[model samples]
Target chain A: MYYIDDFLALLFGISLLIAFWKVRTPLFFIASGACLTIIYSITLFFISETKPVQDIIFYSMACLGCISGLLFIRVMLIRSISLHALKLSNTMTKNKKECSIEDQLTEQMTSEIGFRLDDLQQKGFATLTTDGSGQLTLTPKGRVIAQLVSRLYRAIER
Target chain B: MDTLFIVALTTCILLAPIAAEIVLKGRRLQSNVKRVAPLYIVIALCCITIGAYTHYPHPIVIVMYWCGYFLTWFGIRSHLESSILLKMLTTLQTSNLSRDELMSSYLQSYSTQSRIAELKNSGLLESKKGIISITPSGEKLLSIIDLLD
Candidate 1:
């Protein structure tokens, strides 16, 4: 019975990792991470007859594993080095003519800027304001996030 | 009781990376990952080996230590790997930067030619008849990454 419970815990833990790896956005990650953790913990609690300390440690390990998995996915997705390189390659496929590095570099920069602008608007961090002129302005939430990130940057450097 | 010791040890081991990040500010995020991530892996391996020999082979504790190391490393690496635009916003929190200036500065940081040369050297890219294409492995990797995005 005990071995079976351990097996179930391991199974649930692995499933949570798979879900995390499949997550592409931060919002999806948060929702799925919370749901999966709760389900895994509740299942483990009912099946395992371990001591409180053991149960806590098991739960903690599972949570940490999920977080680590999600973070690994996040880093891979956000890394622009390879993405830019791939984009350049794809661009070359469309243009049979020899392309210069500067052209690819410009395209990459434009793509990055567009991506960030889209993220800001989607997340409500920035807004488009028009009074016969289009301008990007940070929302209150955006300002707060910017400030928090700045503080975090300073702390990391320190 | 042994779990307590293992937890404490994991906490102490985790601090090593934080110290390394602070001490190695001169290194970029990519270089730091290469240097510090392996350090954590080595420490975790040492703990696992020692636990096996000490007759207190708690596999749960080993798992805990591995998770702890990963979390610590991930926290630092992800923060440092933030997009240049986000970093610009963060800097804008203190001082404003003109759009043209920001774009120029950010663009300067990227060297597409060098990056292409690197991919070619790694055999992920090849140019045939003046047309460049990704190798099979490169295509597979790009597709996987695209799915994630």
Candidate 2:
């Protein structure tokens, strides 16, 4: 019983780490959560000697662990996908031992955060002008997120 | 196993940040190590004190509770400091822009100067006479990442 929660938490963390790197889909996260739920239920069932309150505590902590792991993994994956730092490092490799970018992102900035707006378009945050003018309009979902982020960013800056 | 102790533990985990923030408000609290130490010490002392006081302390569960608190704090701090998504969304909030314009605007507004400053501050990259070079440590760090990826 003493070592079991430690083992279970480790198992859950490994499951989440695997689920995240396995694919881009949300299904894996859901599957990992489901697996964790099953593990928790089975473990609690076997440790039935504990009273109802203790069971509640155990389950509550297990639930928190699952949610925390899921959220943490999501944040980490998003960070990895950004890869701006990697791009900068890659750009530095061009000039042998030294380099500089004083002009256009295309010229010397390497990727220059060449993060495509198609990403936002695919996420439904931005829409292209049909004439191939490349102008973007924010979707309602995009507007909502933009508003929330603006507020949060302002608050943090303050 | 004490209900009150568990409740206190959870409450402390959640509320410690509010207390820390209040302490950090007007003064540019430089030593985050010191800021974070108090709550951690309090939690540790609570775990030990509870064991002595009630003689029914669960070490693993209490430690998990502490982990939850620390991770929660870390996640919030990380997001506030480095969330590109948040910064991007905020950039988009101001105006309707084209693909090229949007990317360039974000890069101009936040990415270039700040990233350069951060990289330099971290000692990973250095600029000498307008030429930039990665330090040996930075090269080592990138190599490790190359291996991992």
**Number of colliding residue pairs in each model:** 0, 0
lDDT of 2 by residue, B63-95 (tens): 555665566565665565555555566676777
Assess each model's interface with DockQ, reporting 2 decimals per model: 0.30, 0.34
Q: In model 1, what lDDT does residue B128 have?
A: 82
TM-score of 2: 0.66
lDDT for position B122 in model 2: 61
Report how large a share of the reference interface contacts model 2 reproduces.
Answer: 0.27
Off by over 4 Å in 1: A1-6, A20-30, A71-81, A90-97, A115-158, B1-7, B19-25, B31-34, B47-61, B64-72, B108-149
Instruction: Provide the lDDT at B61 for model 2.
Output: 46
Question: lDDT tens string, model 1, A4-118?
Answer: 4446556655765677667767677767767766776676666655446665465556576656656665765675665567656766655754765446666776677667656
- lDDT per residue (tens digit) for residues B13-59 in model 1: 66766766765574445334556667667666766666556544554
Q: Candidate 1, after superposition: displacement of residue B46 in Å?
A: 4.0
Instruction: Mark the 10 consecutive residues where model 1 chain A has the least summed lDDT.
Output: A127-136
